[model samples]
Target: MSGEVADPKPGKAQRRRLSRSLVIIALSIIAGYLIIQFVGQIDWGQVYRSFGHVSWWQVLILVGVLVLRQTLNAVPLATFVPGLGLNHSLQNDVAANVAGTVTPPPGDVVVRIAMFNSWNVNPVDGMAGVTMNMLNFYAVRLLAPVVGLVLFTVAGLERHRVGWALLCALGAVVLMLILAMVLRAEDWADRLGRGAALQAQRFKASADPDKWSAAVNKFREQMSDGFTQRSTISMLALLAMVAVDSMILLLALRFVGVPASALSIVLVIGTFFSAYPLTAMPLFGFGVLDAVLTAAFVEESGLHYEPIIIAGLAIWRAITILGPLLAGAVTILVWRRRSGSNLNLWGSKDTAPTLSEA
Candidate 1:
């Protein structure tokens, strides 16, 4: 027994690890190819020159703003989760962001639950808080275009853009109203969920209206008291986060020599809001969204500022996207060391919490 030889074949866990690694590799390769193709068309010399006069102090200021932006981003989580302090929330938020960045679907949610468990927080509370934070964030995100539309209209900017903004604003308003009704009235929430479940059962026979309705009512009950009292403050914090994030982009553009004459702050904000939804895409919509922003800037500011626009977008992406990923990775390491566990994103039996429990 002491001299027993181990099996040469990999176990189920090993196989799962191999498959997950393969998936990540495949996605990364595809993303890299797309990004390379995009960069191939850019004029690097102009991009380089654009950064030539950017002062060290300017870079420091940008870094400060970046830190502030992340702080604001963490506020909603702290606000929503009881007994979770700002420091813990920041760590948890960044760790979850990393998970969300890498694997799609339930990876982020699973990591969040595990992190909460590590902190001795209730899994249900964690789930509710995360959901509330996301809803609030989306509510603000959708509503932003409406504000942009108002500014554009007030400035008498292009009429063509107004129509698209108007459509987006209408959609946002409808969504907000629905969200309001669901949050305000448990009956409304139950009815909506039941209706959705019934509609789904049309396509899939397994859908159960009773289960869906009960789940909706449960969620509403859990969130109703806290959300009702703190909705205004939470919304304001998230709104500030959005404003600061947009300002980061503006600073990036201005620092790269894209003057106010070529592109006003309003135009920059407009382009940002239009492209913001794309951030929901995988890998923070790295290549595609970046291309959209660059193209939009070039379209608005003309061909002469194209190089500057490209350079500025790169800076902004590095700050908002790459910076978070890197920070989140480091935070994961710290969590692992502190928790005395690996904190596996794939939810290993030994190291991670199960989705069923959540």
Candidate 2:
């Protein structure tokens, strides 16, 4: 009887792990499918034909600009996270952002992993904290564009999609705002979760985390003053970071053979991210970004749907998705070498000894 019981336990554990893995794989596959379908819809032959039409120098400039946009992508994350002082170098962190953007699952995963390696600090609340940050991000994003779109609609600029645009932007803004409130309302979230868990505990009689909760409260209190003290700094940094993202959109379009109109590109990005959140997938990013830009530009700017902008969007997507992965791999590779021995993932001299010593 004991042997049979033990066998089922192992079997059940294996099944649980398998199920989790399958779920992750399924989500990844779906993301990949959407990306492919979107990009495949683009006429690659047309893109290549347009590619041949552009001057070599213009092409090179576009590529270089794209790289800069990728490199700068991390500024907003650094601004919003609200830890670490102004003295920190932004270089490698930029690379980390590039990696996260390059990798799947909101690109923040890559950023977080690289952060763990570099800083050795395991963030509490994990994805919940990230979701909180996203709340701040899209809340600002949805509003700015929304104001612009509403004005445009009121002015009777758009022929159609005005209601759709307003509804999409408004809905996204509301969603992001709710998430932000939920995230910032940390006590409320925890209390609700704790209540549910406690109810379950009555059925199963679980170990209490009251002590841990106490410790967390203490830590939060300790941090709150510092956060408040630097709230202005943090918020300004955040604003700049968002500006960087907006600028990147403009720059990427310039590189991609799209017209370099700031207002137009911003509106396009505003519309897409406002409406479609899931388009930020790794495999699907290039295609989705293309659609976003295409939707915005073709409608607003009266630009023809030549595939160069699509290619540029592809390049922009590459910077965010593939660039950081490549950078992280390279950093790891170099860390495995003798000369880079003193550096740690956190970039502290004390923790990582030289590879030669190892």
Candidate 3:
């Protein structure tokens, strides 16, 4: 009777909170960028030319690498929790997880939860595991920009745009704050959803409040246990994902007939930090991606973006927006036929068994 509520309809305030988060990120990046462009003596030609390249094969490889990056995410995700009735096959989860990663609203979260739910796991408990996994993910991601910031400064990348370095640092700090919230989530979830709290502790007997309290303690303990067990694997998987992400852009660079050095790949991916550029969120890295990637590489590596920018950005858009959308559509059709009905979100079954003697 204790679990996080499975996808409670967001209240108006929750929607506002989500929107505000996006706005803050967007404005900070945009405003900072404009200042650098105008006040900071940025090379407007470099900014403009970064997008005009053409290399179809390299672009194809780039798309493949992006898809591969998403696939790598599945490794840690599936490995994160143990003994949950994971409904889908490992292949399916990886494909869906990849598709999920290309778009967001935490639709990635939805895909993962559904995979578990299909196995008869309670939705709420699955939700908590998924939530915790994301908390871990964001915590890891915070490293991207922080590392970028320090590297950029030491390596003189900041000479091109102090604003860019600052934005990366800001994102890292925000992610750190989110990580803290995730660590102490149950304490906060207690306030957000009494219903969620009940579902989180689905192992206790008697359906009593006291039982729920005790089970909540156990739930947190189990979560910590899972983290400790998988920390090494999780960290490795994440690093692999990041590597795959960098390679995708490298693929794009190749497509544009440009050969990027090891260090250049590091900076472009760092500035363009997120994997989900196709999300509906306004700040979801849409207008900024092509520009910053081209500019950053040019600034650091003395590369020309004219041909690279056009071809590379085109391929990125195709895979991120079209590829995943098509895959998800296929998943929907197959899942419907199999389940004999449309299953929108996934979850696990949660039922309290009679208290077993300790």
The CA lDDT of each predicted structure is 0.75, 0.47, 0.53
RMSD to the true structure for each prediction, in A, is: 5.0, 8.3, 9.2
Clashes (candidate 3)? 30
What digit string (tens of lDDT, one per residue) describes model 3 on residues 1-358?
5796755554544567667767867775675466335323444465345555544665566666766766666555456555552334333454455535443344455554555555555545555555555655655565555545554566666433446445645765685454344345766433334444556558543345555555555555555554555655665676677657666656665555556563365466555553322222353455555555555555554534443444555556666556655666676567647756543433222221212310
Which portions of model 1 miss their true places by more than 4 Å?
Answer: 1-42, 52-56, 195-210, 347-351, 354-358
Model 1 residue 34 CA deviation (Å) reads: 11
Return whichever of 2 and 3 wins on TM-score: 3
* lDDT, residue 262, candidate 3: 31
Residues 276-337, candidate 1: write the lDDT tens digits.
66666655566667777777677777777877887887788778877778888898888878
Query: Is 2 or 3 the stronger prediction by lDDT?
Result: 3
TM-score on alpha carbons, each prediction: 0.79, 0.56, 0.58
Error of 2 at 123 (Å): 7.1
